[model samples]
Target: MYDVGTRKQALALVSQGLSLNSVSRQTGVSRAAIRSWRTRLEPLSPRSEPCPRCSETPRDPDDPPAYAYLLGLYLGDGCISPAPRGVYFLRVACSDAWPGLIDACAEAMRSARPDNKVFRVPRQGCQNVTCHSKHWPCLFPQHGPGKKHEREIALEPWQQRIVEAHPWDFVKGLIHSDGCRITNWTTRIIGGERKRYEYPRYFFTNKSDDIRALFTDTLDRLGVEWTHCTRAGKPYNISVARRASVALMDAHVGPKY
Candidate 1:
């Protein structure tokens, strides 16, 4: 960030008919900065935007819990796509089965990028919840080319910190997307009498090994036990069926309505 005095000096040098390269050499400012100063410098550049992730001494997002939740939603089922301008769109498909989840996703998008507008585009079986922001990549480093399952998805240190602080919100966000709670019942003989026992459990299914690891890691932090279930020759399911673990999940991330 150059000061006014520096800008004035650079402009003065330019007024003297000095080349941008020469001025940059003398003023120690980038050639781009000196070139932009030729027209006007008061407004600075869009780079001055207060993006927490891009700021010097970068910090967490303004709403850490929302960010953590949004990250979960992104890693679980969200996507970032390029737009017409330099901005990119962050979208998550919310099933029509859960209108409340759609609303919650919109709220999280709003909280994550308060200045950006959130939209819900209807589809055959779901609502595409999305928002446009140039900083989406900065916020979600896990975004990349091709399918997420085919590539690695790892969080930055800062994101891990946020998830650690708001494990429940993160877990709930993932559950809202790729996880669910269901009750499985079976008949058993207790004291020679037929009885029905219902097991309430959570199932988080994702094709990405890294993402599943992230979910299970958070569950571990929350003292919730999870087991891997391989089916169809693939290990893509995480189950929380233990009584205590299911209770913990119920207390934090219950059935999605």
Candidate 2:
């Protein structure tokens, strides 16, 4: 089955007055699949009533830590889509390997907007936790077209305050979504004998400079030292290899459960 992203792209092409054959060719999804998605998502009438939950003003999350962390996750790998009839959708793609992080993300959405329904849609190698809320765009103004690296990402005044108050939580979310802890090995020549030693380090990889800056800035506030690197020949990376820095991160973020 095609993932939500692919299905959404097909639907978008259809909405833009593209033919089923054209959308199928562009998205590589079969024409039948495109038709199925169109039929499933299209409203019977343009005047269909909006979801009742859309009318309720979703309050800002009461827990700053949870909200701030979720914000970091959104910046890293989440997306916001405006649907028909003023319905809004928020989806965060998370690795299936990290079930705990998936649960945490879903819980955060529930806490942030209890009136709305949240569900996980399965995909190959990952799962997308999605929710519908008209207030999502207000919560995440960073939503836009194209890759994040090609666009600007900045926080609003209130979002800045939340991150500043709970920087570690923000870092935790960023690292959990886009960073990893790994072992690095090095060889040393001691008295003409080669010795190998292994050290643990944390690495965060993203294509966006602003997102990398935000991660490093949070690390700086926590007195954690890090360095810049590149991965996969293109994506920028921030790495924390120092023992003290790793310890500090451990205290705050730890490993994904």
Output the number of the lDDT-best candidate: 1
Tens-place lDDT per residue, model 1, 1-257, is 89989987886565444578988999899999877766552432334346788778888899998888888889888999874446678989899999888988999989888876677777789888878778999999888899999998898999999999999999999999998899999999999999999889899999999999999999888889889999798989999999999988888778877
Steric collisions counted per model? 0, 0
Residue 32 displacement in candidate 1 (angstroms): 34
lDDT (CA) per prediction: 0.85, 0.81
For model 2 the TM-score comes to 0.76
Q: Kindly report which residue pairs in candidate 2 clash with one another.
A: none
lDDT of 2 at 168: 89
C-alpha TM-scores of all predictions: 0.80, 0.76
